[model samples]
Target: MVIMKKMWKNNQARRSVSQLLMAVVAILLLGYLSSFVYFRLDLTADKRYTLSEPTRSLLKDLDKQVFIRVYLEGDMPIGLKRMRRSIKEMLDEMRVVAGSRLAYDFVNPSEEKDARLRQEFHNSLMEKGLKPVDVVESKQEGGTDTRRVFPGVIIHYGSKNIAVNLLSNNPVLSSEENLNQSLQALEYKLMHAISSLVADTVKKVAFVEGHGELGYLDVLDITDELARYYEVYRGFIDTQSPNLDEYAVVIVARPTGKFTEEEKFILDQYIMNGGKVLWLIDAVTVNRDSLSTGETTLALVNETNLEDMLFRYGARVNPVLFKDLQCALIPVNTAPAGEQPRFVPAPWPYYPLLAPRKDHPITRNLNFIKAEYSGTIDTVGTSQAVRKTVLLVSSRYARLVRVPSFISLRQIDEKPVQEEYNQSFQTVSLLMEGKFQSVFTHRMTGKYALPPGKTFREQSLPTAMIVVADGDLIRNEVRGRGSNPHPLPLGYDRYMQQTFGNKDFLMNAVNYLTDDAGLMPLRVRELRLLLLDRARIMESGTFWKTCNLVAPVLLVVLFGVLVNIIRKRKYGRPEKFG
Candidate 1:
């Protein structure tokens, strides 16, 4: 019996040693194989952590180191803290794909002890285009305190740097909703800034300026914004020697004068060569300056002579003014015009706050677009080859007024009947794409010939164009008078002192039209907004806390007890009566 026990102990020891050796060898093999064949699984319902194919491609192709400094650190509200966490996680994922090409750090500007030095640093950041957001916090013992936070990032690639603002401050949306929207756009915003800096060639964009369009001062803001990603040029469409095949995109912003046949032909031929155009044309005209001096202005048809061309391409800007009950406010005197002219903001139906469509990538997650004297667009053709997407639409309570009608400030005091404002979802902005048919294809093209050495084709290569019925959509407000006037930000309302999404809308439109790497699709990503139930936490707080603290200890104890019983049953039992 003693010899048998000793032999059994020796066999058990050898078995233990052999099992340990096998486990070690298996782990070593796994570690070696993992280096060559790697994969990660995102079990999240929305696949939030999975990077889009375009983003992965862009990161993999990055040749230089891209460093990012995010200034959304320090103590902030719960919502902002969540956003910061998301930013960190996103950067971590990017690093995994980009390896050494991407790096990022979180910085707190408020950590500086010296007040003057911090202020200087803040000013420098502002100069770099990082806007600050004020956070109002309730004090523990007293009233409240206000802190300024810059929720933005500066990306450095090669020798170029660009700033991207992470927060979307839309007053129309609640704080939570805005944060969710901002998170949805986080990927696109970062990728767009990086792509612009790392691009090998900067494309040229021409702002067509021949026909009394908004001049340098009027479009100064958009021009400056486009300069970050494109080479901007302003010139006339030469009627004598018509040629515009060089520009990638031609923008006709708020042209008040009509286009000549030769100029239109030049644009049509340019489109035939797979060029892009953004046309902000006013089908109906109302003199807003005239209304400033008086209470009323006559709305008339503004003829730019490009109607036939647009119809052939796929859309028509109607000669009617769109008025919506859901509109912006304008200041008007209500005290009989004599009591010191007490001005108060009132709803101006003609100045509609256009709603952006969420389905398209160009307008996804965008704020309300502010427009003045905007008209509706109608898609006019049955061409299956062309696809027309509506980017902006009026509210359900929209009313259309024909040209030759008087627009009076008295309309604000006059109550609108509910029945009269029943038109729903009138198209304000449209995007048309495909092989566009030339306007002069069926007409006399002998008079409209391209410059020598250039070819004119009736059918275009795959092309795209955006038509915004409101011309003033791209025009910025001016603060001062005459030559010294300062241009305000585009889509900024002087009365409300709020900036709308006109800039973002235009930027996305241009990017979508010119995108070659499929990056715009990243803008449509949606993340699940998971929120804790405060009421449930308050009601069952103690029960859940106790379970969390005690359950794991209980589970470990039960597991150990079960293991001991199994061991005893297997090893402590008397030898079977052999």
Candidate 2:
């Protein structure tokens, strides 16, 4: 009987041991499977997801397959590493919205050892029209050693290619904020370009000629840049017989001649018919750009009748000149190049450094717009679809001197002349938005508008942009020397190489204006920086070093000890000294 009982006990112990081993195997298998599943472990607090409506809509509605190729090398700079990491993190966030429509690959150019494969890769990228980026690395040695590294990206779908300019694939624009902004833009820009490439459904914009409007050649930079996205046309709007539907947007550039009532009626009807316009009007334009800095005092030169139409729109263009606290740097008349460079400190004449309103989209992320002989505009009677926002304003410390004046360069003008001219900020550039109730709204109640008898009707606002400050600093005043000014950069010419962020500002303007709020917001992206300043660490070196090295270990040790004590008291034993 004893032998039988021992046998039974032995059998039961063996069965229990076998079951425990099986349970361990099952747990291991379960852990392995779960580890392979998609689990995001984001270390950045800022990277925690925040869904934007526009991004989600674009991703969900994307029809074509967008294949993205991320070119990377095994070795990279630290800054570049940080940037790439940020890019990847942003890409992961994008995946949430992009779903499977956005396909990506991190290509290791070094992986393919075969000569044919390498050649094929290069040819494929080129065939897709992706720009080849040549990266050069110099070894720190007696003899400089150089290596060619290609780091870039290619976005493509159904033969349409949009190569994003990856300037210095290093961390040049590498911040989390920048990465997010770029990614947000990626789908929208690519879609817009691909749509353009596949379908030639281009929108038309015009630069008005005649009436002393800055000649088309003067704004070559603007036109050229705009050419990438618009069918840019250069012409004049005849107030007598205007073709309002000729273009989606119209540019009434610096006009010197006053419009007749008939001309004013045509413009009014155009606005009522939903015509988009960009008005660059001048008030007191002084040509004393060079001499004004000399012994010349302020001179007021009237270009021509500019205020009639603006006044009709509920704002009067100031005929009086403005000397604002916000100013720009102009080249003082210089001696011969070889002579001691003598550039006198001269205030840019009426070239008010426009302070952009942060609330608006067109002026967001803009540093400053340099304009000469610019004027201020004020709202008159309220018009429909006529919500005007201040695009640019002068500093509070500004004063206006009337026309027929000369800039007295040597007039004790160290400080601005204190004048009681409203003592409030006056707007130089104004943005008109919403469905503007046309001046012809009362007239155009019936059918399409006709001449002699006017038609007034309210119209929907086009994705439009305008700046009613008459100056060409932002315009490419200079054209190519060989031919008529082709365009300074964006199919429009600038007068000079002032590098005043004009092109960038204009592009951002177009982007913002054309951008759908549910697609992508072109407003500026801001990033808050917390610098881990080395000086602070160096000052409290010992304590910092200890905190960096031993603090985490100490925390873990304390936690583990507390856990053990709790476990012992709760389940194992009573804490008795004995």
Candidate 3:
């Protein structure tokens, strides 16, 4: 009996040790597996915490360390604080994919106690291309205080660095809406900056300038903007042999004259070689200079000779002018001529404020695009291979005026009946993609002599083009009050002092055309903002405060009571031996 008891005790001890070992091994295994597998569940309705696939891929392909310095820290307004929080979250998510390759720091340049030091810091940031914004804070007592802040970031990768402005300000939008748009665009802006810095080669873009297109001074703003990402060139298409092979994209902005057969053939063959083009053409030409004299002008149809070419390629620029009820304003002289002229803002129907289509990435979430005597675009031909998307359209109350119509400034004083403005959603800009048939295919034999040793191509390689019916869409007004003429922003309205989305729209179109890695699609990621009703919040502040203060404590107490009851029931039962 003693031997049996000893053997039983030894077996019991071994079993107990085995159980302990198994528990230890399970814990170690779980710890090891967790190190390799990492994931985050985005529970927000807008998926605000989710990183885009392009961002993940970009981070995963990092070859060197990327360092970022964000100058958005310190005590500020609530909106700025929220922006700072968003930046931190985005960087944390990026770090997960980039591992140790990505590093970032939040800095407050205004933290220096000395005024001179702070100014110096601000100047340095500005020299590095960071823009400063003046923020005003309302004091609790009665007054207000102003603070200059740089809501921007500088990204450094290898030997290159790029600056990104975190705030997207649209004068037309409310402050809250602008802040929301800034937050929504954070991902695209950051990713674009990173991609630009890491690019191996700079792309080439040219502005076609032969056919009385907009002068260099008119397109100065867009030229300077595009110069940041590309090697911009200004030249006419070669008549002998227009080899556009060196350029990734060509911009034919606001051509006023017709093209010769040779020039058309060259452009056709260039498309056949897989080149992208942005056609900013006006179907109808109205003399704005005549309008300045307070006289009516006849809008005549322009014969650019490229309509047949465009029609063959699956779209046509109609020769009709569009007027929308949702239009821009211009200052008009309401006072008598003898008395000092009092300028008052009056709605100008000819200047339509086009809203972007929400479906396309190029125009999604963009503000109004200012148009002056803009024409309509019609998709033609039944080619299944070509894809057409309208990027910009008129509002619900719009009307079309045919060519040879009269335009007078006196129309501003006459208010039209809303019922008469029946036309709605006229397409002003279009994006076309696919293989295109050459307009010169049938007429290539005799009309246009082929250049020596060059064969005419009947069909084009897969390519893309953007057609905008308004030529003035790409032109910037020049302000000449000072000694030197300063070009205004692309979509700025002097009367309202507001800038529209013209610059962003054109930039997006170019980026979409040149993008090969599908990064431009990141602009489509939408993060909806939930805002509180100010009046309701103010009226029910006490009730909300009381609930917030008392609810958590009550829940904790109730949870504790329930747990105690469960614990007592689980352990208080009588023990039974098996």
Candidate 4:
């Protein structure tokens, strides 16, 4: 009987061990299979956690490692802390798609105890093109403390490194709104940096130089900025055998002279072949230098002769100047001459500060774009094949000055009625996309002779173009002596000491036009920020505090009691065996 009991216990022990081993084996097999499959659920209402398709594809196709150094670290404000968290989460998601190829680190450059070391670090970062932002923190018992922080990232891939500014600041937006816009743009900025660094071949862009367009010196600032991404070329289009097809984008910046029929035909053919163009044409011409003479200058319509071509493409640059109440200030000489003149900043109605459209990707979250004698743009044609979007527009308090009107600096002294400046939302810049009908379609065979092996395309392939009614949008201000002039940054007003959004607006326009992978659409992603009313919060602070502190615990206790009661009813019954 003792042997039988011992044998039975041993058998039971063996059965238990066998079952345990099988269970372990099954768990291991399940885990191994799961390693090959990937799945995730994003519960965010705005789909903030979800990676864009372009981003995912870019990550998955990475052949080599991409190292990122994020400088948004250490002690920071709640806003910055949240930005850091979002960046980390984005990088984590990227890593999943890119596997071990995408690596990143959060670095705190201000952590150095040595002042000299910290200064050197900051200088190095600045040299690497990372702009530092001054962060001011209000102390509980003191005034405030200021610290310099770089909310930027450096992306390294292969033999290249590109710096990306993560903070998108708009002077028009509130601090919170600016931070939210920056957060919204985080993905595009990072992806753009990555794409720029990883590009295998450099794309080509050309600035059409003939026909009295803005000279090389005038556009030097934007050219310098664009050279980072494209192999920029400055030359006249060869109308005899137009080789414009070699370039991805062509810029006609403020062409003052008329384009010959042959040249226009060549340009039209280029557009028909899916070529992109940025037309910064001035409809009304006014010599701004004449304003310095203290005399009125006649602002006449500029005759480029490309109006017909542009009209066929879906927009018209009207020969009317826009005057906005919200405009840049110029330092007017309020004092008499000979003595030191007191230059006071006065609003120059001719120099309208345009607001970017919030609905479009090209202008979303952009700051005010300064314009000098800019004209209005009117969308034409009712073609379903063409889509036009107003990218920049004047404010509600705007007025239109028809061509042949005189512009004088003395007008700044005149206090105009606000009711007179009631022309609202006048379009100044437009983006046109889709298949464009060639201006020389039927005329090519009849009037213009086509080269051998060349065929006239009546309709264009899918393409895009931007039309700005102001030529000065692409022109930069020059400083220094007359013999050796140096270009100031584009959209910079020396008198006001402010930088506008002309450079960014133009860059984004070109980027959108040349982008083949549709990455520019990523700029439209928006994350809405829900903020509490500060006044209400302060007024009902105790009531809210009590609810936040006690509500969860009370709910937990209620749930426990309900579960216990259900359990008692479910299993606390006397069982009768059959």
Candidate 5:
């Protein structure tokens, strides 16, 4: 009897030791996991995330202390409320990512709109050099309107401020894949925008002038936003051309007059000096100054021959009109005198809203480059020459019209089938990167001074973009002044009630051309992936069955079996699990 009692005591001691060991291991394992996870999964899929690297870096190097006053209070739009949660998630991520390098304070501007608080926000905008975007009172539910003020985010590094505009019309949210891609890009965009604003190296982009090019007002109206990122300047290279090396990139936008040999030579020299050019040229004359079309009219085909300069580089802009069945409709035939409209504007055949390719940094997030009177661009590959990529294209059924006479918006029709129509796709926009011979290398013209640089020809010139298709959609169709958008870009369908993508497109292109840091501009992220195969929905039954009936029964059976095993183990019976 005494021996039996001693055996029981020994077993009890062993069991207690094992339980203690298990508890200690559980605690250590959990501690290790908690270190890696700083932020919780609190954001919704409808929102996003990013960090301001400039503010972060400055806090470490310059030791600058910054403050941000977010004017969001009261109730948020349901969508915006979800966004607020996402913003918190992103802010937490930034805090963890920056560690001791940054500190910030989030504030509510509705605190009585007090003089001190209002003054603080205004002072921050001025002192930090941030752009101040006004918030408009818009219509809400219940026959009432509400006044709300907010922007995407703001970063203050030293005295420089980088304000990010998040709310824009996004057409891509139509596709889940596209939305995922864009979110991926958002991270890098936030990083680069903030960093570039604070970086020591300032980039200069000059608009080439004196050849009847589009004036600064034409683009600066839009590029004033650009001036914030690049040093915008007016540049010309006649015989009186100044130092071409002053700029990192030169812009040539719709230069109507012919280029004098000397003038062309100076530009050629600039390219040889490692300067990049963003050539937004049009082969066909588009009457953007016409009436009824908001000064925009489309026409086609010319041999005013720019190929002499471009062909040597392996890409040529053809003066052919691109027509397609898949096109935007403009009202052609309206409702008769007192009847519902019987005829709608048939696709204008030529204004092929060139669909952007899913690949490539520039056109990846780019959609329907809303251009009118666009021309076909031909790319001919060569050896010991530059590389070319088609950033935009029309549908496979697209037709090209050759010029015999002037064609108006009403002259569009289906073209006869041709081999070119079925054979291959035509390129609308191209990228060129390689050597180029100076147009004035063989000819001496006194019109130009001894070139901007020593080189007569550029050998292996840097990469640059040449968009042959005109940016006709760039015309401010919506009539709004200040920062408030007037009418939003027409939706892809009526269901897409957001406007972020269109604005993002312009901003993304500018970022791609100037910053090409492979920051994943087109990639996006999507969490809460719930893919319910509709084919099996009926078979899976309703939520109540799946969550309550079926799940509970399975759990109860599992619990009963587990209890039985434990009970048997306590009594020293043969263990079922073992």
Candidate 6:
């Protein structure tokens, strides 16, 4: 009986060993296959882990290795830690498709042992255009600790490098929402840089000159920014030959002079051929220089000659100035005329802080756009083919001052009456898309004919254009006089010491207009923040902690006791019964 029992035990042990060996072999096979076959299941409700189609396309076509150095490592706030994990997950998913073509490493700038070396490293990053954010954390034992954190990345593709600041500092949004916005924009920003850097043939964009458009100096900052992604040019429209075939996009920024018939025809034909245009026009003319002298300026109708052309296309910039209670502040001399001028900052109604349309990708989550002597935009034209979207509008308390009117600094003293400023939500910026009917469709005479071989298209190929009623939206402030002058960043207010969203809006507009890969739509992705209730945690801190600490151990103990009882019932029973 003892010998028979020993043999039975050995047979049972051999079966157990065989099952274990098979399980090990299956695991090994799975690990080997996983190396070649990469797949991840994104069970997220928002699909936040999944890469957009455009981004995947961009990555799949990368001929050269793109190395990214992310500086978001080390000790950070819980929000930043979450962002860091997200960045890693995003890069991991990207690497699944890109293989070795995409590589990234997290770097903690504060990891340096020496203080001076760390400072130098931070400075180098700043020079490369990576903005460093100062974070203050409260200690458990005492006061707050301050540290400069760089939530940015430097991407290198071949010989060129691009710096991208990952954090979005929208003053209007709370910190959590701002971080969420930054995370939402990560794919767009990274793919934009990659697309710009990996392109073998760089596309060209032109700033149309010849008409009294904003000068090179006035648009220096924006020009520099756009140069990173496009071959930027400044030249007069070729009225004689009238061919803009080489340029992908053309910008007509705040042209004070009139557009000639030939010039308008060229622009119209260019759009007809699937080209993009950004039109920043002011219908009313104001001597902005006169305001600096603390005097009233005559706001007259500035005849740019393109009004009729634009009206026919889809939009009209009215001959008026927009005034909003939600406006920017300007320095006003509070002291009497003779006394030492006490220039105090006061709300300037003419400088309307236009609200961005939340629905559109171009202006989504953008800060208030600052405009000087802006005019209202009216969507005209009933063509179903042409789609017009209002991208920017004035606040609830907006008033339109008619042209041939006086705009005086003395008006600051008079309190704004709620009844007078009744015009609410006036459109100041518009985006027109789809196949635009040519303005010169029926009116194209021999003078408007293109140079040989090219036929005039009465209807445009599917294209887009943005018309902003404010010209000064693209203009930056110059600090010094003449030769030594330095231009501040676009949307920066010197008096307020704050930068508005003008630059971002323009960049977004240009990006949307020129986006061929359909990358702009990815900007619309949103991740809902499911935050833990702080009050509940504070109230039941110890209770939850005890549950978290003891529940798992109790579960394991109960599972072990159940397993032991099953073993006793099956194997410890009397052999005589069997």
lDDT of each: 0.89, 0.59, 0.87, 0.88, 0.57, 0.89
- Candidate 4, RMSD to the unseen true structure: 5.0
What TM-score, over all chains together, does every model reach?
0.91, 0.71, 0.87, 0.87, 0.72, 0.93
Judged by TM-score relative to the true structure, which candidate is superior, 5 or 6?
Answer: 6
Best by TM-score: 6
* Residue pairs in candidate 4 whose N, alpha carbon or C atoms collide under 3 angstroms: none
Predicted candidate 6 versus true structure: per-residue lDDT over 1-578, tens digit per residue: 66777677678768878999999999999999998877889898999989988889889999989999999999989888988998888889999889999999999989998999999999999988899999998999999999889998999999999999889988888899999999999988989888889988888999999889999999999998888789999999887787687888899999989888888888888998898999999888888679877888898998989988788889998998878999999998788878898988999999999899887889987989999989998888788988889999999999888879988899999999988999999999999998888878778357665756888888999998999999999999888959799999999987877899999999999999888888998888888887778999999989999999999999999999999998678656544424
Stretches off by above 4 angstroms in model 3 are 1-39, 123-128, 338-342, 445-455, 481-483, 533-541, 558-578
Model 2 C-alpha lDDT per residue in residues 499-524, reported as the tens digit of each score? 45456556655554444343334243
Candidate 6 similarity to native, TM-score: 0.93
lDDT by residue (tens digit), candidate 1, 144-183: 9988899999999988999999998887887888898888
* C-alpha RMSD values across all candidates: 3.0, 6.9, 5.0, 5.0, 7.3, 2.5
Q: Judge candidate 3 against the unseen true structure and give its global Cα lDDT, from 0 to 1.
A: 0.87
Candidate 3 lDDT over 1-578, as tens digits, reads 65765666668668868999999999999999988766679999888898888789988998899999999999789898989999988888899999999999999979999999999989989888788999888999989999998988999999888788889887767888878888888888888888877788888999998899999889999998888778899998887555677788999998999988888887887787788999999999999888876689999998899999899998899999988999999777778768887878889999999989886779877889999999999999999889999999999999999989999889987888899899999999999999999987767355554446666788878999999999999999998935899999898898878889999999999989988767887777777767888899999988999999999999999999998898577544444435
Between 3 and 6, whose TM-score is larger? Answer: 6
Tens digit of lDDT per residue, candidate 4, span 1-578?
A: 65765666668668868999999999999999988766669998999889899999998888899999999999888888888998998888888899999999999989999999999999999888798999998999999988888999989998888788898777777888988998888888888878877887778899997799998889999998888778899998776666888899999999999998988888888899899999999998897778776678899999998999999899999999988999998778788867787778889988899999987889988889999899999999999999888899999999988879988889997998999999999999999999999887656355554445667888999999999999999889888838899999999888777789999999999899888666888898988889889999999988999999999999999999999998677545444435
Q: Which is superior by TM-score, 2 or 3?
A: 3
Off by over 4 Å in 4: 1-40, 139-143, 444-453, 481-486, 494-497, 550-578
Q: List the residue pairs that clash in candidate 1.
A: none
Least accurate stretch of 10 residues (summed lDDT) in model 6?
A: 569-578
